[model samples]
Target: YAGTGAQRVPLPTYAFQHEWFWLAPGVRPADATASGLGRVDHPVLTAVARIGDRDEWLLTGRLSIDAQPWTRDHIVFGMVLVPGAALVEMALTAGREAGCPVLDELVIESPLLLDEDATVQVQVTVGAAGEDGRREVAVFTRPERVDDDEPGEATCHGRGWLAPEGEPVTAPPGQWPPAGAEPIDVDELYRRVNKHAHLTDAGFDYGPAFRAVRSAWQVGDDVCTELELPDVAGSAQGFGVHPALLDSALHGGLGMLYRPGSEGGLPFSWSGVRLERTGSTRLRVRVGLADETALRLEISGEDGTPLARVARMDVRPVEQAQLEAARRSGRRSLHQIDWVDVPAGTPTSARVAVLGELSVPGDRYADLAGLEQAVADGAAVPEVVVTAVETAAEAGDPAERARATALSALTLVQRWLDSESLGEARLMVVTRNAVAVRDEAPELAQAPVWGLVHSAQTEHPGRFTLIDYDGGGVPDWGALLDLEEPQVAVREGRLLAPRLGRAVVGEPPTVDTGGAVLVTGGTGGLGALFARHLVERHGVKRLVLVSRRGPAAAGVGELVADLEARGAEVRVAACDVADRHRLTALFESLEGPLSGVVHAA
Candidate 1:
């Protein structure tokens, strides 16, 4: 019995039932409380969680064209890509959550492409504190819908370490513009660069976006440039430092590297990258040589605020064929030759002119001489003149040697064609391995001869013939000489001739707005023309135009705006297609599988 008073009441004997109940696996009630950590709300990021008993945190998010419309603005080689600066911002955000406010270094290994309509989950993982009290950070992303039987593999975009905020390093004294720098003509620079690309086949064709270098100058050993974002690319302000802007800043250094007849170089690697600001639309960059092969860049904002610094950057030259190969799948196809079967014809009674060395073993000199002898014996008049020009042995530098040999052979043929003694003679140039099809270095050295001779063929018509013979054995000169084709090849006792085929026009493939068509080098003259064609003719609604410049290219804004008015959506990206990791990441980021790719770049 219990006494019933104002503070005490009579209690009935009953035990409260407390039994275990099922809760969601890996979730606890404390996870619902937002006491220790806050939530992250970003178009690219979804939530943040901390791992108990470990100094680590994970931030998860998704990227899609709808959630981050501006992401579609960054197109590289026809794929919608997330800018590298955005990755840096995400890492910085994660760093801030872990009490580390500084990014010591971050290297973007691959680009992040946004899917057209679907979402790609992203995870920013911050690991336990390091010996230096900094946390290791990594960024990974995967497709949302993967096959049930296939395990989803996340793509790692980058990895680096973040450190606690420390004393800021003193930057250069605030100066509007450095003194003693000679101004560079921006228009002329682009003109020359574009011209070089066209002539040398280097494959770099910057439209408006990649033309980030507004003004530049050379002061002593330093190359200084003023870079500004294009008006259409104002959305870049959301990034930590826009890739196009940063890439353009580096373009200023190109003025220093440009030579009259050499291939242009691109950034190969970056080290010790440090960013101090969130957005920088305008920058004044100063690049100096770190050593013989690397560069050091110091960057600042419009008001002289230090923005970023790179201790070292290595730049390397690239070839056009290499870039093209990287953009396509499967083996690189060789130039197709339309083979012609020339009917056997009676030997011409007229004199034939032959040029190039026939003295070396395996040279077709004996066969050619036999034909000349047979013609002389059969007819009263000498039917052919077998003139042999000895090929010079490779001497001095290999390139110079090849050039010298080619020029020597060309001079002989030109003199023969111009001479009255050889009037009305059908000229034929012959060589062994001179038309280099395998060795690119030798090809580069010998290409001019082929170019000149091919032009002469078009101008002179039936008077000129060029033949490449295998140096392993003698060729069948009788059969080759009887053929009417201007270009022929003799390999392993067989004769091949170049034949022209009518150009065939086929119906364009069907495409819909749900998928995308990527046009590499999309900002160029031809790319723009095709983009318009795809929109108007093929009914393509989504077009991704990729170039080194992307939207920053000159006239790109107008082009994009015009396309938009025409009911076509265009996204521009500034990326190097030759970068395998970036290219793979870009492909994975697409909304759906690409409808088609026009590899103009």
Candidate 2:
């Protein structure tokens, strides 16, 4: 009776869409603090300490526009930011050394920006004083990497409360530019703030030393303005005011209440400030209008007296996709490679030598002046030299013979990282199936010698090792010199290495989000953390990066303004992907086709 028309129609319920395609992580942020060191007299704090017995303190500092060049004159939508009134004068010098000197509110979450050849560090902290003496503070910042070994990722950028006092310094009440007002051309208000800082997210550029206003008026719902600072905008004495004349003392409330194509907003919150003067290079501003999203500031000194007062500042809607997701929020720094598990060892005696194409089996050495004539015929400086990397076998165009075997192992590791008696020897390099473990596909003429020796092991760290074997004998210089992992991988004979690991995924992510993604190790720091784990966790919308110091490296303009403020479509490309004719003319100047390809150079 079960014969003809296949019975079980109820079986259709198991189509299994429980999904989670996994594969995308490492965003990198982590930190704690400790290093403050001593002496701090201010002028942008240098160190203050205290945070361990709990009444909290911290402080620490550094800022760069090349050591304060008026912080490259403010900028705004064109980037250089940092001014929410320099975090309300660094929370009024960390609330006057935690005795709380009154800020009563700072809030401006994130928008530090900086990066014109970066320097940032900044800290602040404060906290623990409550019982009505107030304290809380916060500030934080980062970008100071001088080749981090561990410890970075700060961020925060302003937090509030410091009390123990309240507002007072008012002044600014009419006459000086009021009588009938109207005058405000301010060079057509800075050409409508550089034509909407080039169209939207409410733009602004202002560089003639932040065009410090100079003369402005209006006078209906108020807007005064005067400022000054420029004479090449240099010394604001030692700032308690000069954050480019208090960011042009709040751009006269964006030209007296948003106009040049409206939709403007930024300086998010200040409430009852009150400074009293610290180096005013000719001030006077004003503003007024407290509703419709706040603003009532007041600065003084073009003789009307007073110095600074806020009562309220507020302003939110910041968009550039919310300051590029708050500058790629917590800028994850990840470094993954992962393999681990090599334990089960044996051999150890060493003096290995093998450098470059003398067929790389072992005791070979045809260059480095025949190993410096067998160490001046006394030999023994070989604690391990290895090298080899000559793939593209059976080739002639296996990517131009793997770019001439990675430019002859990048000219012998730049002559073994410029000798100095081979600084306690290490070198290694060797290769063959050139790394691809876990569901493989590597040997494409030896995977560009592991992407040109991982950018020469990321600019020489512990002098290079990177093995890769899986065969043609001889790598047991006493079990590979008892192993150490600067990227290993032997396999089948046992010994893997690499390690960074941590990516578990739980569900949600089908991904494709269209093309573009080249990468190739260029925007420094592991190519902007694998292009910010492919534009914030694999929604990847086009990249390119590649490096040979493109855009003259060193945080290539803050990693292309943090992956084009996270909406992606970046490009960087300095090209030298080992140079197969400038990596095939940078992939025929790509503007299309590239669903993926990271090879991290």
Best by lDDT: 2
Error of 1 at 322 (Å): 9.4
Candidate 2 yields a Cα-based lDDT of 0.71
Position 84, candidate 1: lDDT: 57
Per-candidate TM vs. native?
0.42, 0.28
lDDT of 1 by residue, 1-601 (tens): 3565447666654432222233322111233235554456443554688898888999876666665554555444455556555676778778777888666666665556554645667889999997889888889887665455343457787788788864453375455456766877887656654564342355344445556787877678777778887643434533566655766666655554555565555455455566677666788888877765566788888788787777766655644434333333211112244654455436554545443355322223243335445445663222344443334566667677667866875785576566554345566666554454333232344455556667878987766667766665876566666667777666555565665555332323566656899998899899999899899988888888988888788889888998899899888888678888877877887776688898888
What would the TM-score be for candidate 2 when compared with the true structure? Answer: 0.28
Q: Which ten contiguous residues of candidate 1 have the minimum total lDDT? A: 326-335
Error of 2 at 430 (Å): 74
After the best TM-score superposition of candidate 2, give how far the Cα of residue 148 lies from its true spot, in angstroms.
Answer: 25
Please give the CA lDDT of all the candidate structures: 0.64, 0.71
Kindly give the number of clashing pairs for every candidate. Answer: 14, 5
